[model samples]
Target: MLKHPDTTNAATSKLAATFASQQQAARAQPYPDYRSRLHALTQLEQQFKQQLNALAAALSEDFGHRCAEESLRIELLPTLQGLAYQQRKLKRWMKPEKRHTSWLFQPASNFIQYQPKGVVGIMVPWNYPVFLTLGPLMAALAAGNRVMLKLSEDTPATNQCLQHLLAAVFPDEQVAVFSGDAKQAADFAALPFDHLLFTGSTAVGRKVMQAAAANLTPVTLELGGKSPAIIAADANLAVSAERLIFGKCANAGQTCVAPDYLWVDAQIEPALIHAMKGAFTRLYPASRLQQDYSWLCTERQRLRMRTLLQQAEQAGATIISCAEHSWQHYLNDGSGLLPLQLVLNLPEDHALWQQEIFGPILPIRSFSTIEHIFTELSTQARPLALYVFSDDKALQQRFLKHSHSGGVCLNDCLMQVAQDDLPFGGIGASGIGAYHGKEGFHTFSHAKAVHSKGWWHPGKLIYPPYNKNWLNTALRWLLRR
Candidate 1:
């Protein structure tokens, strides 16, 4: 059934109305004591966890799969993990950073203070909506700011569930959820947030950035691209193949970090493909829809995948489908389904080769040398992630040095983003600012430098500026020191 656009817009506004009211009240209160505001965080922590669990459960029912397990293992777990790590480090993160004072001002002090941007706007993506919202929300609240969350319209059921969950724990003034279609999402972006965070496709990210620019709001954009994986001739083919498959198939290839293309040493291309084929067959044996292999989220997504695969095939790429029963199950149910395909010998001109295939299809493009591969990659937009598999330490180091990407995996794949300790974000076209762990805390906060100096510190130094003797002595002393 087609969703009424007005319904989505109304739901979004209804949620945002509370935060709007709070913003008005806050202006009247003018810096309401943050100790009480800070104290609420303790209760928020427990309630948030429970809400996440419930939302995960609801998301599972809505998606009609083992979504609860996937949500817990993937989304909710990572969010809670970030919250726990931040909670442990918040005090230290909040500690004032000291700086050196000039020798002339002997008794003065200088330090930098981190302060919150009044209200933060978080525009979340449908994929992992729970984690995307929770992760940024944690950062905003930690910095002592109110948050307005714009949930994705792609996952309406999940957004509705999130609305209820957040409302149960927080009022509209402190935290609120906006559930809306594209227009309302755009309006939410234009709402004069002190800072805006958006996670989605590169095209949409540009629109969001432009919208935020209207208000001069600083933005953190997490966008997607065709991330590449290079399999060197010297690589351990078996290990590289296994890791690549895991990264590609995890989340059914919905992840931005999933390897979008493969650059194989021409001499080893056939062997690498064979190894990957075996890995896929072994991991997801063709007998279950509720297994390692999952269906594309919607029929539209499935059709898009089919179109890309067909385009690749027409361009003379050899396609090999992963033998998954999920395809057969969908076929039996009279539903559209696209197989997890592996394309071999794809030309650079094909859409599958040129664009980021955000589905289960993986394309292989051969390269004779690292320079040739890098030359090709350099022409494309910088990827969110790059995976290079090389046993030669020197080659690996050189690859890392030469490539500009959001993140890199030395001999593995997408697991780098899983490490909460490391900052995750894209560079150039892939994304804007980073977030995760301390990086996230820093992304949402602004540093204001503070200095304490006596009023009597510096009248004589500049009062007689025209004196050459004084200027010479001052310059000589400073320069010598």
Candidate 2:
């Protein structure tokens, strides 16, 4: 059961005290040098590796029946790769980057010093808790900042496991974790911090930003939108269906980047639908669907997804459920498990088409021409990820140039985020900032520009009153360039 967050003085005081201690610790160590930062990251990596199996098990327990293998592959693998990538590049990233100096300031030095932003707050969503939490947490630590994390109330088991793992490895002043209901989450967001990063729905993301605004804290929001999959006319049906099925079905479509709706060429819509059904059935056969697949996290969430499907059907949408007994079987069962439900002909005003369908429900739309996609995309909120499947290089390049998204995957799905070097984030309605690799390091650091002069007073000459003829001549000559 969820309760409103306790906003009484006691709760607020506790949170504020935690923030104060972290701020104090940050002041004590001001800037952790390269060696210290590297050591901190190494400690994090080793601790995470030691607790890897336990983390997977806890995640499974939280989801009722999340596949342990899937948790290891999707949640654990990329996070380890990210940590190693940071370790390999931390040394050079920490160095002061040399910048060009103007002719007026020649014989002097100019560079930027990457300074830690003191303390950072990270808010994790229920889905992929480990990846989302550690991804940003590692970046903040690597940038040499103390961090406080607020785990989702939705996953108590995983949160407890992860909180213990972090506590065992790091002291409170270095890394801390907080847990509470949504209202409590709001209180956490209102705290004063050097930087705050949140990963969740766009609706909650807005509230987080508004709370952080009181402190004028900078934030990085990884919010979700209805990411779309565009299948070009030249795309191979078998290949496209296979790739999309895995992306949408993995995590049972709870992923923020999962394809919410697909736009296929009208001519091949039937053929592609057949291919998608075949692909889904082959991947998750009815006999083993419950055993191998993950259930919706909670009964509440499961019913919300069901309500979306029911409302769509009420509004005259066609549903093609793939699995044992189809989607109808779960309506009365205590289990929140739902198989892949492909919806079509849903009314334009239905909520299924309006909101981010973060479940195993995918709405398929057929487009007569590729250009029509741009017209629709232009009006809707910009998504965090976009999938364009096309064998034709010309059409592929067209999406790359015309569409706007946080990231684009060519001929693939969800693999874009696996690249440790790419900066992952969204724009416009999708999200505010990015974090991954070098961009991640910089996001948690303040780049302070430094200009040094070696006893040369040439700049002083132009600082005086502009009455002298020589000064006027010099200014005129400089302005000409």
Across residues 232-308, which tens digit of lDDT does each residue of candidate 2 receive? 88898999999999999888889999988999999899999899999988998878787778889987788898799
Residues 216-318 of candidate 1: C-alpha lDDT, one tens digit per residue: 9999999989999989999999999888988888667877889998889999988988898788777666654354344466666767776786677688877
What are the runs in model 1 whose C-alpha is more than 4 Å off?
Answer: 1-19, 25-44, 51-53, 61-67, 324-339, 458-460, 476-481
Best by the lDDT measure: 2
lDDT of each: 0.77, 0.90
Total colliding residue pairs, candidate 2: 1
TM-score of every candidate relative to the true structure: 0.90, 0.97
Error of 2 at 322 (Å): 2.2
Q: Which candidate has the top score in TM-score?
A: 2
